[model samples]
Every structure is written in structure tokens, then in C-alpha cells.
Target: MESVRTCVGCRARASRSSLLRVVAIDSALIPDERAAIPGRGAWVHPTLECAETAIRRRAFVRALRVSGSPDAQTLIDHLQRNG
Candidate 1:
């Protein structure tokens, strides 16, 4: 079946294929290119604004069920590379 997920940043719902999956691994936020990584994952658009908003709103940890500040370096780099 087709997968649909809501972006934690903009709270916009989009197909899983269209939205990027950010997974929490080793207490860091890493972009899941194939969306196959196990563990808590949150969906978001591949835009910096959404990322920043998600961070600002403190949505990542909640969405991913992680504690402490998550290292979003990978996610940031991914957005930079895509943008």
C-alpha cells in the first residue's frame, strides 16, 4: 500500500515517497534516503525552513521519541546538498 506521512515541521501530509524521512540514530538526526532505517522516524520536507521550524518547535525529539538534543548535522547537510 502507498504510505502517507505528516511532516513534523509544516504538519503537511504527503506521500512517503515525496517526504523525506529523518531517523534518530545514535542520538542524531540522519536523513533516511531509502526510509528503511529502523527506529523512530519523523517525516519532513527536504527544506531548511521546515527543518529549522521542526527544531524550533522541538518536534524532532518528540516525534522520534528521543531524549536530549539531537544532532541534526546530517539532516542539515542533506538539506544543504539538496538545496
Candidate 2:
């Protein structure tokens, strides 16, 4: 069976390999290309809407336990560039 992860935006459970994993690094959002980042990570659908919703709602901050330095736009841009 495939590993599963929950999308922080929609709260939908999906295959871990199917969702995109994003991690905050140096106050920037970077794609977890290998899904091996040590810090907290957030999962989202590869679609624009889900990415936008996650940013608009600040889901990453909550899920990742980040505070005062969450870069929502950077994350959105990363998702757009990578999606």
C-alpha cells in the first residue's frame, strides 16, 4: 500500500507520493523534492486552487508550527513554479 498524507489545506487524505511536499527553509518555501526534510512539512494538491487556499488560510503555519516568519507568497510562488 502507498503511504498517505493529509493535505493541510483541504484536510483530505491522499497518497503521500501523489501530493507535493513543501518545507520552509531560510524563510523560503522549497519543494521537498525527496520528502526528506527534517522540519515540519505541509502537503497540498498539485493544483493551483489548493495551493492558493493553503496560502490564503495559513495552513502551513499551523501545520508546520511556524510563527512570525511564514512566507505565504513565497510558498504560493513556489507551488506555481513547480506545479
Candidate 3:
């Protein structure tokens, strides 16, 4: 069976493949397309609304256990392009 994860933005449970895995690198949110990046990861739907919600709520920092605010523009840009 496929794994399941919760979207930190909408707080909805979904199949792991249906959500995008994001990781923090140097205090920046980076998309983990392969979900192979080592470290804690936060999952979110690959939609601008979900991505923005996650950023607005600072979910990445809390989920990734990172200090301060991690730049979310990269994730936003990524979603925008691929959304």
C-alpha cells in the first residue's frame, strides 16, 4: 500500500504520492520531487493555495524543526511554474 501523509497547510490526510514533499535547506524551502532528501519533511498539496497557506502559517519551520523563518519563495515559485 502507498504511504499516507498530512498536508501541513490544509491539514488533510492524503496519499503520499498526491502530496509534494518539501525539505528545508539552509533555511529555504525546497521541493523534494523524489522525496529522497535526508531530514524532516513537510508534505503539502502542489497547489498555490496550499503552498501559500503553509507559508502563511509558518508550517515549514514548525514541521521541519528549523529556526527562524525559512524563505518560501522557492516553493511558491516552484508551485507556480508546475501548478
TM-score, model 1 to reference: 0.93
Off by over 4 Å in 3: none
Cα misplacement distance, residue 51 of candidate 3 (Å):
0.9
* Index of the highest-TM-score prediction: 3
Q: Per-residue lDDT for 50-82 in model 2, tens only?
A: 877887787877777777556666666766787
List, residue by residue over 1-83, the lDDT tens digit for candidate 1: 89889999999989889889999888889999898988788999989999999998999989999989999988999899997
Clashing pairs in 2: none
lDDT of 3 by residue, 1-83 (tens): 99999999999999999999999999999999999999999999999998889889988889999999898989989998999
Work out the TM-score per prediction. Answer: 0.93, 0.81, 0.96
Ranking by lDDT: 3, 1, 2
- The C-alpha lDDT values of all candidates are 0.92, 0.78, 0.94
Clashing pairs for predicted structure model 3, backbone only: none
CA RMSD (A), model 1:
1.1
The candidate that wins on lDDT is 3
Model 1 scores worst on lDDT over the 10 consecutive residues at 32-41
Considering TM-score, which of the candidate structures 1 and 2 is the better prediction for this target?
1
72, model 2: CA deviation in Å?
3.5
